[model samples]
Target: MKCKLVDVFTKQKMSGNGLTIFYDYDVLSQNKMLSLTQEMRQFESIFVSEVLSKSSVRAKIFTVEEELDFAGHPIIGLAGHLHEESGDVNPRTWQIVLNKKSVKVKTKKSGDYFYASMAQGKPEFISILSENDKHAVLRALNLTSENLADYPLEVISTGLPYLIVPIISGIEKARILLPNFEDLLANFGAKFVYIIDIGNFEGRTWDNLGAVEDIATGSAAGPTAAYLTKHQLASVNKPIIISQGRFLGRDSEIEAYVEAKDNVITNIWISGDVAKVANIDFV
Candidate 1:
């Protein structure tokens, strides 16, 4: 099997979140895909198969842990790779069908990078964390009430539900302090937690076990944008620039645009640049 490595959310190679994408991957089993994702040591990997047409394909995403219903960078990176393979200079849109839903991504070939934008659709405002749950989450994240911003720590989902923890400062000091952090979020209906620096629009998130910190989280960007717009911190219909991966030295920039009508968020779009890396062949 052959897989291609690409960096998402950055124009420069080796600067963004690295993703491994396997094309024509229907031959691989789910267990094998999971193993491959673990072997690659990437935050996530995407398998593309069942290409119905030039603009549509079936995709499955897997982390070192398990398969995901939907994700952000994987779809964007997969679309970028498809654009490169098309060898067309003009921009194109692709429909990537995942287990949960189908995502539409627009891809354009830039000078040295492929720019992809995904339509994450409407944001679902889930439940607000109660006072006690909030305290527990803050404890697990090693944060205190003082570190929080005036905004409410809420749960939001575009594809994956994330607990949006807004903080004014101390982003660098944040880390997962509990092994049951995932369980802690489960009680609040969150699959993961995104600790965001509202002052700087930067954010960070780690695996459930806190074993690894994600470089750039496109999955969380849509919710973060919605949270900002809902609180009137970000302008609706304007691009919100999110910064991430700086602490790990792989600086990445994600742009999110939120459209609202009558105080209701209608659409959320996440975009980033992708740089192609080397291809790997597995025996």
Candidate 2:
């Protein structure tokens, strides 16, 4: 099988989040895909199969742990790769079908990199953490009320549900303390947690085990943008720049745009630049 390794959310190679993409992966079993993802050791891997058309394909995403119904970076990275392979300088649009939904991504080739953006559609305001749940989350993150911003800790989802924790400072000091962190999030209907430094426009997230911190989370960008716009911290219809992966030394940048009407968020878009790294042949 042939696969491509690419860096997402950064124009520079070796920076941003690394992704492994396999084409014609429909013949692989779920267990085989999981094993391959673990072998690659990338933060995530995507299996692309069933090319329905020149501009449409089916994809399945996997972390080192398990399969995901929908994710952000993989779709963008896949679209970027497709654009590059097409050898087209003009912008192209792709429809990526996942387990949960279909995402539309627009890809354009730049000087040496490709930029891709996906329409995440309307944001879902799942729930606001109750005072009791809020305290539990703060404790689990080694944070107190003083460490948080004035905005309420809320759960939001574009594709994956994320508990958006806005903090004022000490982002470097935050860590997941509980072993059952995933269970903790499940109690509040969140699949993951995204802690954002509201003032600096930086964010961080880890796996459920908290063993690995994600370099750049395209999945979280849409939710963070919606959270900011909902609270009036960011103006609607403006691009919000989010910086991530700095602590890991990868350094990635992701941009999000939120559009709203009557103070209700209507559309969310996440965009980033991708750099092609290398192609790998798996025997």
Report the lDDT tens digits of candidate 2 across residue range 1-283: 8899999999999999999999887789999999999998877899999889999999999999999998888888999999999998899999999997999999999999999999999999999988899999999998899999988899999999999999998799888999999999998889999999989899999998888889999899999999988887888988999999988999999999998888778889899999999999988
Extract clashing residue pairs from model 1: none
**What are the candidates' C-alpha RMSDs?**
0.9, 0.9
Candidate 1 at 243: error in angstroms?
0.4
lDDT of each: 0.92, 0.92
TM-score of each: 0.98, 0.98
